[model samples]
Target chain A: MSTAFDAAEFRKALGAFATGVTIITTKAADGSLIGLTANSFNSVSLNPPLVLWSLAETAASLPVFRAAEHWAVHVLASDQEELSGRFARRGIDKFAGLDIETGVGGVPLLKGCTARFECKNAFQYEGGDHIIFVGQVLNFSRSESAPLVFHGGKYAHATRREAPDAKPRSAALSGSFNEGFLGYLLGRSHFQFFGQIRAQLADQSLSDDDFYLLSTLTLRPLISTSELDAGLAAVLRQPSASRLPALAERGLVAQLAMTAESDVAEYRLTEAGRDTALRLISAAKAVELEILERMGAEDGAILKSLLKRFLGVVDPDASVLWDDPTQVAGKIPGSGWDS
Target chain B: MSTAFDAAEFRKALGAFATGVTIITTKAADGSLIGLTANSFNSVSLNPPLVLWSLAETAASLPVFRAAEHWAVHVLASDQEELSGRFARRGIDKFAGLDIETGVGGVPLLKGCTARFECKNAFQYEGGDHIIFVGQVLNFSRSESAPLVFHGGKYAHATRREAPDAKPRSAALSGSFNEGFLGYLLGRSHFQFFGQIRAQLADQSLSDDDFYLLSTLTLRPLISTSELDAGLAAVLRQPSASRLPALAERGLVAQLAMTAESDVAEYRLTEAGRDTALRLISAAKAVELEILERMGAEDGAILKSLLKRFLGVVDPDASVLWDDPTQVAGKIPGSGWDS
Candidate 1:
């Protein structure tokens, strides 16, 4: 049964306990700066301000760390993934290009971290294949930046969970829509967000379809009737057959001569249309700012990220209308369009 | 400068290092199970299999842990927040109602964890105000559940970070919509999601507005014209005046006679309309399952939670239409409606 003690399985089990990424740095006896990435760091005691991290005995820096009288632990921020990667590699100068500061006993310190601890080496204990170094804190500092988390052997982002009492409101009747329904949430979010921009539309005397058509024109200097139809098909039903001519009638859009010898034609936004679209877009952005500010910055980032991923899953080929001429040409052979 | 090392500040600085929540449990000599919440656990070695965690020397269960020959570490799942709270409390039977199992040397093992490690106590080191217990892991098991994280002294949920190279596609023209724009993301997600269910709507020979009206009817047995207008004001510009009549013409909706001496009228779905709505809703739910499965369960959960929170911010009062009778009564005077 002793053979059942698989190291890989043991390591995988240990990975279940998530921890923040940290880089421990120190000055060696040979006067060279040494640092390595580690997540084994933990607080051991508070009364005497003791913290500990283990270094593998087989590591190249083990001798340096064992002899060091002082060292510093830098608790990385959410945006420091590159730094973590740099420190995790070996046989290279990790501090070569960084703006480094000297901590207790001239130990190297990295900036832009969530927290930093300068400590004096106190005791070392044997931990089988590793050596555990316990340090007495000399000084420490912290910032408001969110911490970088490592979980299941990969980097992760951590967001504050909703309060236990903040459960989703249920629908009054069975089989009815509720706050938990994804469709209801998406529809409500889209409508409520656009609700703020509708006032600007009313002021400009532009209908919702008119606004959609004008925005499509702004995506390119001139959009073909087929392209417009394909782009706005999901929302406007038949944009070219209906809304485009209405916009042209109002002098907000102008029909362009077809460069090819075919009945197909293109449309471009008039100066008024462009100006109106820009104005409304700017106003919509302002509303977005107000909403995202209410949602915490971290949550806002996460929401946008997940939404983009969702779009990637459901609309992988929906970028045709927004593609540059070069990309469009690549996708459609012999189009000859160049950006 | 030593005064800067105040316990509270030091504690706050230490909390900058995020960690996964865990409960290390062991059996006392008297056959009582002892478990306490901790975030101090960390992997110390691979060969010979060692892990360590610190416990306050003054803790009530320290004696039991000190004399125990075996213990188990349970890495908690995201759904175990209540269990974490229960174990973190003092002087109570934490496992009184839990479905527990006995591990190596009869240590208590909790179910429904991300991972579990059974260990033999190998060494105990003195750590100022605490003692560090290092264990040699005997055997372990893991599950695919997402881990529960702790950061900044609060419970957190961990989400996988986006791949470094998956940047949002840029717009070809300046001031045009890109994949990163929140409005574009929301609209595209809404339409693409609905795009999948549109085929079901087509089979029923119903337009988008018709489907929306029919679904809204299912929220209540009968809805007043004014209430329909208020509920669908965002999507359907004039549902009662336009779409409701169209559905009524098709024999899907029927107008109800006024029971009171008022000019207001109400509408309800016919048997045909109700069946059509149920079929369409079932199809939509199937589409939701497909999309969410592609999004990964954890991310899908996070996305829906964030969307609900966003609605809470922008459309807090949007629930007026779906309010139960009691809430409606509180909202409107003398409407004798109750759930």
Candidate 2:
């Protein structure tokens, strides 16, 4: 408990997580509506034409956001970090000095954006410390302009100029990758694909040794505990510790066999473990496809990992400012990223 | 024309495009090496384990990164923004006074990172302002730690706790998603899956409208432009723009003589256009799958749009930083992300 994670510390970790810029809105008093800037927005469906974005526990726009006939989500342009900053702040009368206007859902639509999505409230859900609002996008639009960038914790515009003269690595995943995951292979010529699995077991934390055990399970499942170390090392591509017995003792894994000579220890996904692994894999795959599409098919592998690093931010339900925008949107200055 | 996209303007715009965090290293003078921070890393393979990352043009660590035995990528942990910041700056010995170590490929390993990937140079192409270094990740390791984030050219971390309390909207793309493009949908999920796609298109840029038109043609061939607009509007949820007979007059689409009462125009992929569309869509689909695998299923949607924003980073070439860590290593300030 002494090494407790603090807000600033965790914020540093979480900000590494990526997110989409969205604005949450609802009708206000005096016959008009109010909205706030956010990067917690997400899409939920295509069949029903639905969308979703999250809010913090500290948002000032809550009442209005919850009180509208329709709230709209404007997917900020890559150059709209200022807009994201403006609306994310509290007590600023967001739309007062802006050139925003209302559209289909009568929600505030920011100016100079890449796309606008007008929606009616579809559903709301409680997630950990945040509120998840699902918007049924009633109308949407796109522009040729680029959206703003939100990396780490800063706001930036796009560098539309041409890149320098050298060609780097190919983005194709298999036979073209050199690192972690999303390396490449076959059948990717025309179709998009992704998948994985996730679960919260063992306190939602696993050690390097623990991860080795899991990867071993992925590569070769069901071996005796004694042989697990070697198997894990092989599959893990590094030297591994003798981790089987401890894991088994904890019931996170098992021996499950009898007879001394024939007795063996192997690694496999526990019911909970399997569930989590699958979920994680599925999520990773899903993002891989997205990066390829967005980059228009360049650097498929890089985008996948980049997206993976920002997972926390993308989850949206996990933020504090989700409720009160002002505090969350405070301009702490100093390059904004240097925690 | 003096303001026709100056370097600073492009740099500002490029800053708006968020990226992930990574460190690129090169063997230093006196048989040692230097490594610095970066957000331009990406994945490239799976079967043989390939990956890529970019280095910026003005980075101080270029000399060593260009001469390293093997470059390793340490996907920074969310709690490690300080580490990202330190490495991103110049004038200090990056590897001094830290508990840093090295593993495979003789590459320096940052402590407590989410994962470490060791790679052998696979491909190196020059594009625009960055040098793309593709590596074949010979070995890799992972730990259950969160990663640092980058946004708007700065580092950001999350403010999440293990338990749920008074947060606002749950940011999880958790409940269900409805409003999205198969284009947008596929764009996010595929790469995070960390799978590979074999593509056949050469590098080229297409307008958003053109990309949509081409995608439509790839999905449903021979549909007229009007039907395309209607279909696209349905997909986009945006009202179709008012396009008069001028398109037909310009032969972008042609009038059908089959209608006696009215001349219904038909839009078909031109022979050249068809070839181009087929090539581009094929390439786009391939990349989309790669991105999907990278985004993962849990935060799939946000990853979709997030990467969509990143793609707008202006690769300077059709190629992007797939996972090499060398393309943009020296180019921007603040290590090119939220450090």
Candidate 3:
């Protein structure tokens, strides 16, 4: 279903969209071979050069990435798209059959990466589907190689400067992430909204599931009876008993259709629902921006893609109940690839 | 003269290096627009949301950049390379005929740039021949179109993501400047060394003369004494009184005869010279990497090319020279195109 979440297709599409490529490798505590990849990594630092990248939380190499005492990121050569792809996919060993040498602490050094920076892990932030690992660079390497690029959603080798005598780029990618937000507008990707924000929102009383429900009603209002039945994801397990009428009495949601004529009826949001949705979207937008700010453009793009991809994978399709003749992949029944 | 610094030849050869295009404009205190070209833009912060770019200290608009309370940067698209070239050139009233809008703090924002962000000056570092200006993004704008890119020393347009369900590229060209460097090493092109690592090494202490030396060295070092002599900038005469013998006395360099019959000698770095040269190379290499790290591949390449072009204009062939090329364009007696 949905192409089985073909990692390659995802990467190629991701590359086609273009993201920055950073060689993220971790140094073993004993300083042995560092597993390096031109992962589109980013920074989340102020007091230090904290940076991050998303790894398949379930990758076998996660052990290496986790056990390492230090991690080094080498911005790949613009000509090294092949290298970035190699590291991105699931492989037995990333360092296999490549021309590499030893770096400080015997960390494997990519031969042609534009820049190599070794960092110490600051912290890891877990959200809906992916874990964001932050690292701070301590030592690094720099080269004359152009960075390998991930653009257009695939591994794309970057173009060279047209004229050596060109001018500087403008402030195209500039913005910040809202670390203090308590919610996010979850995308179709498995990424959940409000997990991080609410964690930081400082309200211990509100559960994530509750926040999730609040967010959903606020974002996609006027959910028809069937749409709600298909997309609700059992947020509160339907109360297993009949609480719909009880909640309806409370004015949380009101049925628009007098009767379910064709197995579907409209359930419109109340004024309170609209207000809550407005508040949630704003907070999530702020947090989305904060995430962008935390992750530089290139890395941020990767962050968005990776996190959002998970969303597209695990989340229910909005078209679940629609009579789709073309067969929308996401709208299919029970087709999500979530673990 | 060797084709190495044959200005025109070098321009064409290095032109083989590609980059993204950008038009940098600022609003003078008088509300007039001051514009220039640069490829040395980079992202520096995310928390406070910051971007950084470099300007040759000797540009005509240096004062405008230095004195302005705020400035706007327009990341040019591929079709805008002409704009990129025009702004980087000296003496031209860059904004005379251009259409632009004022944003955030009335900063001049050029039309057609894929993205734009306004910033309050955050930090400025004097790196070699340029001033690295760090700005905190106060406001920004985004467009739905693909960004114009500079690469292989030329302008490149983006191919939109393939249809159906792909998300449009939200990030513009910013961090992919080292393609030329990768090309140089990969033998895809030559004379791209500077396009790959120009202002990246600005933070390094290497002088423009040293950079010129490095550039020449990167292209098969100047092994001949005459070539070495020709490499030293003749335009800037050292005060006779300051012509001390420390260079010779330090024994850091030596002039060796090419052959017994010919008086032609080769200028070669001595052990100390080699150490110094390696040190400089390493430092500049770091700068190159930092450029990749901060700007990401596409933006980095564009920024490098833009800034390098500025360097070529301001200093001609001298690495440490920061004078706007326009000042001496007429005064320097080589190509009558000097004007």
Candidate 4:
């Protein structure tokens, strides 16, 4: 282990400490704006309001920050990853075309940060290869935006942890159903959410299988029986083969012209079917919006992100359903994924 | 905003920059262990392996810390939240029963931390009401455990973010089935996961509704028809009413005595039914393990945590299905949740 104590390992050890991404900005002696991405910023004191961040001694902006009387630290928000990337890069104009606010000593302040601190450069201390700059915060402002996290040498999402007492108690029966099971949570969330949209379906006289078939058909203007079956395999109990003909009989669906390339029949939603599908979809979207609002934006985003990652891990090949032409261009006739 | 530059506001702004929790430990002049919880630690340089953290001037151990020649910084893991709390409190024997390793200068080093840095206190700088101690690291180590994050004054879970290029492309047809939709993700994830266990159900000659009934029945030893219906309402198309009687005929379930309070008959899993349910559940759990393993432990945990939170927001009342007696003490007949 001692033999492996190299620079890469040292960096890896340091990466274990997660930190929020920040951009420290200052105005140079010649009035040029200088800024760089950093995750080393931390609050040092509360009474007199002091914060500290470090810059490499050989950094291009070292002299500018050294001579600066005042600077600002902008804590990037979750949505500001692109801005963080911009400032972290070298030799590019970081502030070009950006909406900025001038802070104390003419330091450039970026917009939409989760928090910003305008500070007087209090002291600079020497370190091995960096200059530690401590600043007395003169003024600051903050918003409720979620902070952008950096960990393990990559960007990450931070979700609030549940209080220990808030965790759901186990069920009475051992080896029975665990409400905390991933399967139960997924199933309950899906069914409960769909339950809210069931009334609209009932008003329209649409069955569960019917709604599944109709929604699957909307993915493309024309879908072959084979492709439709593949997509609806998980949600549908009855085959689309039997359901499509009934929808065609109702004039809600129509069969498309057969391409000589294959004998499989293609189907498309008729005008009535399209209208019915869209109305119910809008209602489903409304239910989604209501539930997401209850969960709040931060958690809602985290849930969706984690679900997407889970899907990627469990169903990597399911992308064909979304028809990303790159994967299934020739597989689907007249695919418009790229078009 | 300038007029509101109070301590609370300043603290709020600083909280916007998330940080990993750490416990800085040192040995007092009298050989007592001194440790405190902090999130102000940051790495300042690599060449000299320097790190820094601040101690409030008013802290009880300030005198010991100022005189200490060496200290250790332990970056807490996600499971170390309780330990962090313990060290944060005052007037307690913080290291009373802990297994500690003595580092340089007899500093107490903690176990199970994400990272540990043993450092020689090299410099002390004054910052308003705090003293910033810069340490040159003499030795350090790191583990792969996920670090505990602090954001907005609360502990948070940090999950790795997907690369921008890795996000799934939007569907070609806009208003159709978006694979990225939260509802679609929930539905697809649930269905696909359950799809794996369907083969076991089929082998057991059970339909989807029958399986749902069987699983719900396992939640309690004796579940009344009304309570069972409420539980299975979401996942089952046909009510447990017809399914339970059929299961009884198949010798998988049995009807219990009717109470004078109501004419409703309760049902319990027969020995055969219990065996069948357990077999299927174990199979489902196997599938879950496979999928979660593929997703990695870190992402799997984050996924489950987020899903649990999602369920809390969408279906707080669903706890009754799990038969948490505190929530539905008299609602279910013969509930043994607390047993």
Docking level for model 1? medium
- Writing each residue's lDDT as its tens digit, candidate 2 over B73-184 gives 7777655667777787878877888786766555666667766666776655442244456676565665545455564455533222111122322233331211121221
Each prediction's TM-score versus the true structure:
0.89, 0.29, 0.35, 0.94
lDDT for residue B255 in candidate 4, whole number 0-100 = 94
What DockQ would candidate 4 receive versus the native complex?
Answer: 0.55
Cα error, residue A160 of model 3, in Å, equals: 7.8
Q: Give fnat (model 4).
A: 0.72
Deviation from native of the Cα of residue B58 in model 1, angstroms: 2.1
Worst 10 residues of 4 chain A by lDDT: A330-339
Per-residue accuracy of model 3 over B188-256 as CA lDDT, tens digit each = 111122323334444554433444443333333334534544433331123211221233355545556
Question: Where does candidate 2 stray beyond 4 Å?
Answer: A1-4, A157-339, B1-339
Cα RMSD to native, each candidate?
4.8, 31.1, 32.3, 3.9
CA lDDT, candidate 4, residue A323: 58
Better of 3 and 4 by DockQ: 4
Residue A273 accuracy (lDDT) in model 1:
82
Evaluated on CA atoms against the true complex, candidate 1 attains a DockQ of 0.49
Sliding window of 10 residues with minimal summed lDDT for model 3 chain B:
B182-191
Model 1, B1-339: lDDT tens digits are 122768898999999999999999999999988999999999999988888999999999999999999999888999999999999998788999899989989999999999888999999999989999999988788887888999988988888777665433544455665555677678777877887788777886788778778888888888988888888777675557677777888889998977668777789999988888877877777777787887777788788888877776666666357666664444533221111
Q: Which stretches of candidate 1 lie over 4 Å from their true place?
A: A1-6, A29-31, A171-173, A317-319, A324-339, B1-5, B170-174, B259-261, B317-319, B325-339
